[model samples]
Target: METDENIRLRQALEHAAAELPPLPDLAPLAVREGRRRRARARFAVATTAFGAVTAGALGIALLPGSDPAPATPAAVPSSPAPSASPGASYPPVVVEATPGVTPPDNPDGLSPAERERRAAHQQRVAALLDELLPEKVTGIRPVKDEVAVYRITAGGASFRMAVSVRPTDEPLAPCPDLPEERGVCETVAFDGDREAQLMAMPVNGPDTTGSYLRFSYGKSRVLLSVDPEAVSAPVTPRELLDVAADPRFLDLVEDTDARPVETKEPRPVAGG
Candidate 1:
């Protein structure tokens, strides 16, 4: 397929190649190319190092405080173990018995209408207490069932429990000067507008004992007392607290029917 023009071009190329001087040594060129590649690599490494230093400097400048030590990972708290029983979480707590007795105090001179209302309310509360009392603590009986007062005895434990509900303008009672030797008394904030006082002391001249939990809920105040000596198993502070915080009690306090009648002066009830 070679044409006349192709043959002429091929001859010209061979003549030019023969006429040219011997090819210069190519070792120098190869060495120069390698040097160029090495230089480029060095420049790239230096650029990368400079960029890393600049980024670190900028990060330090943007921090809020002065140069600080590197932060460590925070410790994560473990989840609490599941409780075996619902009551297991609330362990038994017994307030030690002490000497002397503090007779129950009553607020007197309520009007007959108020007394009637209180009596009805007391009966309802007694019913509630009977229902909520522990199963083993049996034979729940009311000794003195009146307006705002309930004295109850359970089983043959030989202990008496009294529950009293009344009206109070104050959210909390001031802490009385209590001696630690006698017993422990604590005043704690129950909620936003309510406070509670818990005292465990001896009753009936140290032979018997009592646990008193007094707390305010909404517009009403409640006092719960349990004589330890009257029962085989004395009620614990935990139990008292649980009872005080019962939703049913709060419902009773908020109930319109059970609300106390506000009166300026106390009036005596004929048979109250």
Candidate 2:
């Protein structure tokens, strides 16, 4: 029941299929797979680079000494200005003002009896500085406010030694809160939990400078400062520290509370 045209069509299709040479072995699929692998490697490298940059930025943000960000400013309202001189024009002038440097305010607060007691304590400290220094100290004493001034000859040069006292809970504060005094401070532990902060610096003077030592004894804090002058050699900071740590010097605080005078609280120093 088949026609000659149907038989011819079937025979033609079989011949075409046989001549196609086995479909050329699937067109080499590994090329597409290799391209995919390379893309993944590039993406991983880029991700690692981005992560490193982010970590570096975070580290900078967390650094201890980094400057704080500037504060945002609010919008300002505009106002009409007066006219300038008819024929004169002036350039913009910028002025930078330096903040004032001042010592800590009276810690005892403002009171008559408290002021008298503080004055008495200061007088005693000044007397002690005069009496207790090493035997080599001698000269016509000069007058200075809040400090004991003495002229001394040492190491072939004559210079003035200024001894001052600063009572505080801690030796120094952090960053801006610390005193503006020029010196390097070091803390050394002593008996009975007492600590002595020793500092030394050569300020603006002729090859002469001072050393400062602050310590806590009993309920009060004290500072003993000494300035020595010499062209080639100056007193070592250790000797000054030893003098400050001496038992005789520490005994000065014994009469603070025992005396009938009311005591003043020490100014607090910022601590880290």
lDDT of candidates 1 onward, in order? 0.47, 0.42
lDDT by residue (1-272, candidate 2, tens digit) is 78999999999999999998775554467775565455334434433343233222211111123221112112110210112112111111111122232223333354644444434343344334333444333211222122233333342243445443433345443222224544566777765676677777665564556766666555455555555533422445566666566564455455542442333445655692
lDDT of 1 by residue, 232-260 (tens): 23675556777667666556555622545
Provide the TM-score for each candidate, comma-separated: 0.46, 0.38
In model 2, where is the ten-residue run with the lowest total lDDT?
87-96
Error of 2 at 184 (Å): 4.4
Best-fitting candidate, measured by TM-score?
1
Candidate 1 has an lDDT of 0.47
Q: Model 1 segments beyond 4 Å from truth?
A: 1-119, 143-145, 189-193, 228-233, 256-258, 261-272
Count of clashes, each model: 4, 0
Off-target runs (Cα >4 Å) in candidate 2 are 1-132, 140-184, 205-207, 228-234, 257-272
On lDDT, the candidate that comes out on top is 1
- Give the Å error, residue 123, model 2: 8.1
